[model samples]
Target chain A: MELDFSIEGGDFTQAGQASSRVKKVLKQLGVDAKCIKSIVIALYEAEVNVVAHAYKGQIHIQIDKDKIQTLITDEGPGIPDIAMAMTEGFSTASKKVREMGFGAGMGLPNIKKNTDELKIDSVVGQSTTVSMVNYF
Target chain B: MKVSEIIDQLGLKVIAGEKGLDREISGAYVSDLLSDVMGNAREGQIWITLQVHQNVMAIASLKDLAAVILVKDLEANANTIQHSNEEQIPILSSSLSTFDIAGKLHALLADK
Candidate 1:
């Protein structure tokens, strides 16, 4: 099965909607509890990155018999330094965003730690795409 | 311990998600940073923090936390309450600071 979701930038009000929906689907499909948690965390952090930095984004999810894959593509201020952004404590979030307790620079790392595979593609001044997979 | 028991013992105010008062708790994690909680907090743990936002509920739901205790009399936003209700994860409020709440919760869970 496949699912699609759209995320809006700077919209903290609905930040977790996509992740929440995906979680429900996973639960109904009888995915393992532990695997569901990891998938949810990774998907959520990816969703938040779009809401926090992108202009807008689309999330594509594919659920197979053995694994789940997600690709989050966002049109935004593309990350200039993917390596730096992956660092645990480096962030480019605005002051207002930081005050909300996000932008702690832990999003990507958390995603990487939870997911079995992670790939990030970005071009400065254009967009960023994050792909992640978690095996059931 | 159960969430309701914690409320009675700690004098916590149920701000929202009262339906989850019976949820079982196994541990406690204290952090104001959302990602830190996402990365480290375990299932069935009560999160004690000063963060009073909607994303707190998001993390609690995604991580399957027992409940959330907002310290120092902090209150959650409207959206946060809505999500809490939807997710059925209690959002408790405490007049005590984070340190005080964490200590009490730690001692309680330790005894368990």
Candidate 2:
């Protein structure tokens, strides 16, 4: 099954809606709690990344008997260096955003750590797409 | 220790999830990095951080944490509280800095 939720940039209200829904689905599917936790963390991190960095976007979540995948594509000022952005403690968010306890440069890295697979594609003026999957 | 005593000893407020305050916390982590928190936080630990976001509650839930405390007078808004409630995690706000909360919590639990 699949679930999709639009995460509005600068809108903290809807920040974890997608992850919450996914968590519920995994529980109902009888997925292991440990695996469910991993998916929740990775999806939550990626969702926060889109909300904190992008110009507003949607998270596409797909779940099956084997694994869970979260594809986050955003239309915003794309990241120039995926390598740099993946580094811990590297961030480009504004001071106000930083005050909210995000943009510490851990978003991408966290997604990478929790998921079994991670892929990224981006451009400076166009958009960014982040794909991650966690296997059961 | 009950949540009431922790609140009394530390001068903290239960922003939401009142049902969970009485729950005990085993170990608490002090980090603003959400990534570190995802793997490091264990069950029943009070996550003491200066960060405030809806995702924080999500991370705490994944860790099976007992509660989340925003140190140094940071505010955890309505949505954050509501999310914590749904996750069955107590969302707490403390005027004490992260350092102080860590120290106090450590001292209080060290003997036990």
Candidate 3:
């Protein structure tokens, strides 16, 4: 099965809707509880990152018999240093974003911790794409 | 224990999602950081925090949390209350500070 969702940046109200829908689908597919939890967590973090940082984004999901894959691409002020951005306590989110209890710099690390395979690509001034996969 | 019982015992005001008062409470996770709660909180746990944004409800629903307790008498945003009602995950409130409420809740759960 395949799914796609559009993410509007700065729209925190709608941030996790895509993840929630995907979670329901995974549950109905009889995915294991633990597996679903990890997938949802990673997907949600990525979704929120787009809402928090990007101008806009898109999510693509593919689910097969043995695995699930997610690709989130965003147009924004892309990461200048992917390595530094991946660190647990590093973030460039604005003060308003931080005040809402996000911007703690745990977003990427949480995604990494929950997904089996993770890849991140970014161009400093243009865009970023995050791809992650988990085996069932 | 059930969410309703905690509300009664803790004297937490039910802000919204009264339909979910009967939900089971496995435990509690206390934090104001959205990502921290998302990363570490387990399903069926009640979340204690001061965050009043609508995204708090989003995280609560995605995590399948039992309920959300807003400490220090903080009021959730209008949209947050609306989301809580729609999701049926109760939004509870306490005038006590996060530290105090967390301590009380921890002691109560430990007694169970």
Fnat, one value per model: 0.76, 0.56, 0.97
Per-residue lDDT over B1-112 for candidate 2, one digit per residue giving the tens place of the 0 to 100 score: 6555677777788887787777776867888877678756777788888877777887787677878888878888677788878776788888888888989877876755
**TM-score of chain A by itself in each prediction:** 0.98, 0.95, 0.98
DockQ of each: 0.80, 0.54, 0.95
Tell me the spans in candidate 3 whose CA falls farther than 4 Å from its real position.
none
Which tens-of-lDDT digit does each residue in B17-101 have in candidate 1? Answer: 9999999998899898898998889999999988888999988998899999999888799989999999999999999988888
How far residue A78's Cα lies from its native spot in candidate 2, in Å, is 1.3
lDDT per residue as tens, model 3, A14-99: 78988899999999999999999999999999999999999999999999999999999999999999999999999999999999
Please tell me which model should have the higher DockQ, number 1 or number 3. Answer: 3
Estimated TM-score per prediction? 0.97, 0.86, 0.98
Question: Model 2: DockQ against the native?
Answer: 0.54
DockQ ranking, best first: 3, 1, 2
Q: Is candidate 2 or candidate 3 better by lDDT?
A: 3
